[model samples]
Target: MSKATKTIHAAMAAHVSSALDALQAAGTLPEGIERGNVTVEPTRDPAHGDLATNAAMVLAKPAKTNPRALAESLAEELRKVDAIDSVEIAGPGFINLRLSDNAWRDELRAIAALGETYGRSTVGEGTRVNVEYVSANPTGPMHMGHCRGAVVGDALAGLLEFAGHDVTREYYVNDAGSQVDTLARSAHLRYREAHGQDIGDIPEGYYPGEYLKPVGEAARERFGDTYLEATESEWLPVFRGFAVERMIELIKADLALLGIEHDLFASEAELQAAGKPEAAEAWLREHDLVYDGELEAPKGKTLDDWEPVELPLFRATRFGDDQDRPIRKSDGSWTYFGADLAYHFQKAENADALIDIWGADHSGTVKRIKAAVAALTEGSGRNVPFDVKLVQMVQLLRDGEPVKMSKRSGQFVTLADVVREVGKDVVRFTMLTRKPDAQMEFDFAKVVEASKDNPVFYVQYAHARIASTLRKATAAGVAPSADGLDRLGEEELALVKVAAQFPRIVESAAAAREPHRIAFYLQDLAAAFHAFWNLGNDRPEMRILVEDDAEITSARLFLAERIGQVVRNGLAILGVEAVDEL
Candidate 1:
């Protein structure tokens, strides 16, 4: 109901809504009918029309009429709009519409007028969202294992911000977990190595990455052999705090390589020290969501040491989980679920919605965490939207062979090294070329290849081509002008039709919380532009820059400039730079 700048599709839907309202007021249709199902989208086949709507089909049954009969009435109302050239009722009461030439020209002007902010929408207005992503444990430098989620989270945050949501980008630091203890032990070995001790062959349980050497060196520099001969208890806390801090610094640097920066780094250690988990548990107990219960052993498998023990359990089964989940261990330590539930509770205190981008490896735990959030929020009489997006691991390949270890990190390929080999834009764009949950292979050779098969290169090439055309036109004594846009033909208008879908794409992508939709949309726009550009191969006049006619040349250049703007806007959302020249 709140109006912002309208996309072509939105505008068409609004027209249908208005027509329905008029029909209701005139007693032709029933009043108080739900119109939620009405939708407008681009027609699949070009021969049919430009846009199609299912308003009649969606509202027909509710209006006490058949679909075809309602479609005829709706088509009559739609045909009266000046922008619609013709309306045709298709199979099953779907109505397709072709727009007048002036309508496409108007959209081109809107693109130029809106410039970089063309695709922005206010549909998510007045909502504040918390987006937590790439909370890789603070035990080591980020590798390919963390790269996909990092990019996906950052891109989704950007997409939501573009769609008019107030977004907080956060990274939850797992400093309280056992992994950081392993990190401290690992750094201790390196610290000894730094102090002229031959600490050979990092032991099996400790981190082996050479990246921790710097942390050890820094520890030695700060403590100056103070803890070299101390007891584990005396030095454990000191080294644990020191190593976690240093690892966070390293993590920040690695994230920077991919153009990601978090607004907050919520620490699990600090959260525990603040007694948030205890508070959450107390609250859950008060609401009867938590109870002391005995749980069965692992399903489908048995351990000789396994025994039923009473623990504080969350009744997650009541909220669609497979079974009740334990919040505490026999030793009275909080489980990962306990700490994560408290963390999400903390996040929900200040945001209207919560989204976490996690690696698919954590897929099993998603249900329990979601159930906890739902229990805490809904039980407190507040409704907070929550979503968990799982990003699959990226299989790094070089020339069709699996890429193994990074000599720098000593375990897996570091994200920084990959970014160094291929630029940040290439890495970021390539990660998004597939859906987040679908398995994918990141081929260094394939991503850098200068061919249509490479989406990153292909989309960039389209923008570069448009830039080149604009420069050539300027050198040829012509400038982009809207004056001659009316002289454009069907081919040029078709490109505009594709570009005009940007606003709709932004809203839908933001609504779905899928940033890859923007990437996919850009690919389609790039393909359309390239196909139009290829027309110049056979007919010289079909080119963007014609030597003889300055009038049409300026018009075409204007069109190209707008397309480049759209590409830039889309790239900006993905944290990929839109290069004027590749």
Candidate 2:
């Protein structure tokens, strides 16, 4: 890495480390205080300082000193650093430090040198993470409920990879469930119709989507009436396999429209065939985590078939769930929870951490799954971190009114429909405009509108405007450089300081597993860039491309280019395109 391209936080952190070393050498502070607790971040109120930290507070207990006292000593050592202009101790021992204008200028130069690689981090340390998302049942196509999870999960995996993780994107197929049985039956009716048999009226419990017609035709062509006289048991498995394969292809094609592809697809049928769920249950039984018990009827809901029966149950209450969960049903078949627990156990075998992105309808399932992970990991004498992120529903809107939706496979607003309506970038960016757990409105009109009200357009416009500046500067034989970077005035320097926070933003956002933070940060950075450009409107001297004063113009262009670089990098992590022109 070029010395000029060191991140601003890295540079400040080095100074902090050295200052701690100096204190340790002088015997003023202990030698082995944990420095991982130390952090350097930009303050929200610029009036307080350029950057702030709670290091003194974090270390005071370890150093056997009050926070304010520790801050005073730390300030004395910090002021010796050349980058710092002044240091002050705020209430409760927050240390705020202002850096010289040269620090921000050097940051701009670093960004210009590093370009797209500027904001990438090494915080993840190459730990393996398995991210499972959009595991929509292979019985149908991906619908509106699946879109948010797909985009969020993909973006999060990208963020973790950019932060130096070994990430595997995976999908778990529920092809072994009763849903697929119903799907196979539905395809059977269609298959008969394809063979010129009079089959009418899709029964109530079977899938009625017209998309299965193609699957039926394919089956008839492949088998040629061989299954026409077969028993129900003989044909059920055959048709189930055929229909599942076709639906998975359709699901994959829909995912491709949004630029999503899973690195692995785990089938529930295969896991069941391999006896994973049975093995997990046997292990839990040996550990006394599983038992034969009868469960109470669910609260606020009536079960008409509430006959009490002994079932294999997991002791979930020990791990903080409100109730012990049943893992096996009366007929000895594993429940959905049982299959899911086994799937997660398989994921935990290869990953140090596991993340599942599910629609909010599964929020209640989270606690039980986490409980199972705890019990299963305890059996292995290894603890793995498992997190389930619930993505809420997206209410589709057109213009100002709500758009009606269908849940049927062929009738729903498929992921492809939205991606086709607006561009993929728009759909992806709009999905992340809100937090994953918050209900959001996917407005077709607003997303495609070319205005500041549309965040995708606003942020993309910033990058495109910078591209225009670069083209103009190139035609006029000008380029960004630090030779006369000191010519930048206070407002320009202030903006550069904000631009330098890109690395910090990335680290914090990735650590929190919230890629939405990147979206919001890019919007803020874009607003700053546009405001800087507007200043040139009222004052001719502040214009970026001053042919007469080439040195000042070079400094301005250098700042603009760096801001553009940050915006581009941020958009890349969110899986959105940083268009050259919007």
Candidate 3:
């Protein structure tokens, strides 16, 4: 196979698989043995070997032999391959293989050959995946509360695409909720104020953001006092639609500052208007998945104050949820879960998989929604995949002090404000430093600090240093060349090995739906390159661009160029720019 077609780990896995096939053909092992459980990956400790495999352990039982006996046979077949420098059978049955120097050198050439397209994989096999995120209620502008989810979802989509999945970036617009009603009422106050009427301070239960002033002004400009004195029923629907439209526009603009654009914007109001929820309800009822049932009262409410009510309930508990969930209120209105269930069912119709990025506060609703999707899809015998990833809130701070909310947004710090203060790359890279579900603190002072403690700066500086070295080398007429790659030493080869892990990282991160793994891997790769650079401080011979010899300089420059390429690729997955200079 061509170098561009497979990852280093994948190549090693194929070698093991070939050895197993040879064993079966020789009658040393049973035919048709399941190889799905076999795995070949980098060893946890580099001292063990370049790669380790569980092939022997996985096949020993089927072969009716001891693990050590099977490993001995496997090692014999593996030794026939030219690339295997040594194959060691560790405890029980683990087979560890160390490759020749030519293997690592060839990988460096592959890296330089692939360039920006490196680290991409076809592991997803073109499965259509729907990623819905940042479905914040369209009641206000984008705030810090919604920032993390937006970044995570966008990065995950990028990662999936890199892994060769047909991904759809979607945003579920929550325009049918009661919050829009509050938004319309708030817009009316601002509208009345725009008409020279003294609307008093924002009343309770109304949005108080000064950001809504533009919406009010737009409403005045369009309506021109046509509904100034109309009844609430006459103007409520008009303002609701108008406010939702304006807020969605504001949200898209705010998201643009962070380079996030969704491919589709699904509307809750439209779904209800098209009777999707009713359709889902009818399907559930026909399949005995839902029925008229009464639910227990509030967990902490007194029994005397609790009123028993009968409502249509879904069998969420049967699918691992805590309790049966109500799909509609007793008054015959669809509940939030009802609308959300129908929305996910609609999403599943066009995609093979679904992923939702929700805030940590929505953790309680996760099980119910997962159950709904399971029932909806499994009942139809489709078995579509679904995942709900919860992202925790970010605590904004400056110089170790908790930052105050933005007066413009009224309730929280706006995402645009933070992006403007530090930059889109800093916000994005910092949000990915820690896992999404873990608590994160975005310190205005710390993220921009030019030190090793700051991962964003450290990783970017590594790429910048490599870029600077390449530029200076070219200035002296030492262009990177693959001809001198054979002259490189173990340290240079070690850097290539680290960079070669990018493909595996991308595939694993996409499979796990955790894009932060790419962030973590970049930091490690950056550290390795930085350590190699520091080697030159005491040993002049270890420097990349040596004055006496052009051959070694070309070899090291080639290594540095590829290292920079890997850094840029990893940063690209996180939607961060790889700066050429600090």
lDDT of 2: 0.88
Colliding pairs, model 2: none
Reference-based TM-score, model 3:
0.98
Summarize candidate 1's per-residue lDDT along 1-582 as a digit string, tens digits.
223344566778788888888888877789899988888888999899999999888988888898998888888888888889999999989999999998888888888888888999888985999999999889888888999999999999999999999999999999998888888899888999999999977787788887888988999999999999998888889999999999899999999999999999999999999999999999999999999999988777577767889999999998999999999989999999999999999999999999999989899999999999999999988889899999998898899999876543367788898999999999999999999999999998998999999999999999999988888877888999999988999999999999999999999999999999999999999999999999999999999889899999999999999999999999999999988787
The per-model lDDT (C-alpha) reads 0.91, 0.88, 0.92
Residue by residue across 55-117, what tens digits does model 2's lDDT show?
888888988878898788889999998889999999989999999988888888888778888
Q: What ranges in model 3 sit over 4 Å off?
A: 1-5, 300-303, 406-411
Give the better candidate number (2 or 3) by lDDT.
Answer: 3
User: What TM-score would you give candidate 2 relative to the actual structure?
Assistant: 0.96
Model 2: how far is 420 from its true place, Å? Answer: 0.9
What candidate 1 gets wrong by more than 4 Å, as runs, is: 1-6, 300-305, 406-409
In candidate 2, how many clashes are counted?
Answer: 0
Cα RMSDs of all predictions?
2.0, 1.9, 1.5
Query: In model 3, which range of ten residues has the least summed lDDT?
Result: 1-10
lDDT: the better of candidates 1 and 2: 1
Candidate topping TM-score: 3
Residue 185 C-alpha lDDT in model 3:
92
